[model samples]
Target: MNAAPPRVLTVAGSDSGGGAGIQADLKSMLANGVHGMSVLTAITAQNSLGVQGAWELPEEQVVAQFRSVVDDIGVDAVKTGMLASASMVRVVASLLRTLPADVPVVIDPVAVSKHGDKLLGADAMDAVRSEIVPLATVLTPNLTELGPVAGVELRGVDDRELAAKILLDAGASWVLVKGGHDEGPLSVDVLHGPGVREEFSSPRVDNRHTHGTGCTLASAIASYLARGYDVPAAVGAAKDYISGAVAAGFALGGGIGPVDHAWQFRDISHPGHPGRSKQE
Candidate 1:
């Protein structure tokens, strides 16, 4: 048999809609050529319209899942999203502390859903600041999330840079301030780290089915990192992947749809599936 692929673990909730959360993360990992594992923290009754209901898993169960995965399979990289409560945040932070120092951890502070439903509790923000931020190899926060986590109102690029600095000083190795929510022609993501700052800009795709963009981006970064790409390179590659996924997004339900995680394979034919044809 051949050697196993790079391993990536996602500690997050489950999206019943199969748009964001663990579903998106695993798809991204597979697309990036990594073995994806999951430790589910919560489950949401969600769809293209919105999140209807959410239930957090027991804290002990969450811990047990993490231990089982890390102790046996082991992880080359980890990405976190949609931790439901303060207690959950604390539990995940403690679990992360047990990992080997070399493993990269991408933290996507998922506080709200694409449809404006709350995922993380308001009470959990403090725990995220005190416990989770420090352990991040790369903290991925969008404009709305950045405001609360960094305690600043993001008005422009300058504000975003300052907020990123605040996160960098808060013990995160790097902070990616995403500009997808901003009203602009280009979707620019700013990466700020120890003596390193770079802007990665891509033309904003005109698609509206961007339900899982954050989860996809962060998971792709972890997948690339597991495959041995450095931080900046991993993020750049992830941006490219997300851009294509967004462009190829399709309508799934009555409301907004999801990005196509398999966008790169649109033109490729599998054993049982035929490739797309030209205009009929």
Candidate 2:
């Protein structure tokens, strides 16, 4: 009999666009050779353009979904995205508290969508900080989210590192401050915690179809960690995976599309790209 694949569970919102949230998370996990599972916390009426509306699942339902999966299928690692309300955040945090301490939890403090649509409400910010953020094994927050989660404005690379440190102090074992919104020819992401800091640099791929980069990255990190990579190693592998996905991104639909989660398996028929064919 064949061994079962590594199991990865995503607790996040639903993106109707199928580019981010639970969709993207599961796609990333599968692409990285893990069996993916999800617990939907909210549902968004979203598309390529922006989010039109969002409805969070009731706290009881959310908890039941989580328990059903974790109690039976057994998640090797868990990744969390948008929790639309304070109550939802509190509920999810409480559930996390019940999990085994060694289970890796990758938290992507999703605040806004790729099109700048706010996914998290202001009223829920405090709850996120008090309940969710501290439970993360690694907290992945972009620049816009850094201020609220880390309680400081990040203006430069130095500021980003400082903010990551502060987030780690807040409770996360490690922090990855994504600098995708920063102004530079290169995108710089800093991972810092436990008195160790590592910087990852990649030339910015000028693509507007970069919708699910954050979700993909955090999920990839969780997937890799579930496969037994250390935090730094997991972050490094995920960074490389996202960079390649970004570089190979393609446009879809009418608005901003998503990164190709399966870029590593894409066919390269161009004559000059002989060795770049998709993997089976």
Clashing pairs in 2: none
- What would the per-residue lDDT of candidate 1 be over residues 134-219, giving only the tens digit for each residue? 99999999998998888788877788888899888889999998889987899999899889999899888777989999999999
- After superposition on all C-alphas, the RMSD of every candidate to the true structure, in Å, is 3.0, 2.6
Q: After superposition, how far is residue 102 of candidate 1 from its true place, in Å?
A: 0.2
Q: Which candidate achieves the best lDDT against the true structure?
A: 1
- Give the poorly placed runs of model 1, Cα more than 4 Å off: 268-280
On residues 1-280, what C-alpha lDDT tens digit does candidate 2 reach at each position? 9999999999999998899999999999998889999999999998888999999898889989999998988988999999987888888899989888889999999999999989888888888877887899999998999888877876666776777777777788998888898887999998888978789999887788788999999999999999999999999999988988777767788988888887877667532222354431
Q: In lDDT terms, how accurate is model 2?
A: 0.88
lDDT of each: 0.92, 0.88
The 10-residue segment of model 2 with minimum total lDDT is: 271-280
lDDT of 2 at 86: 84
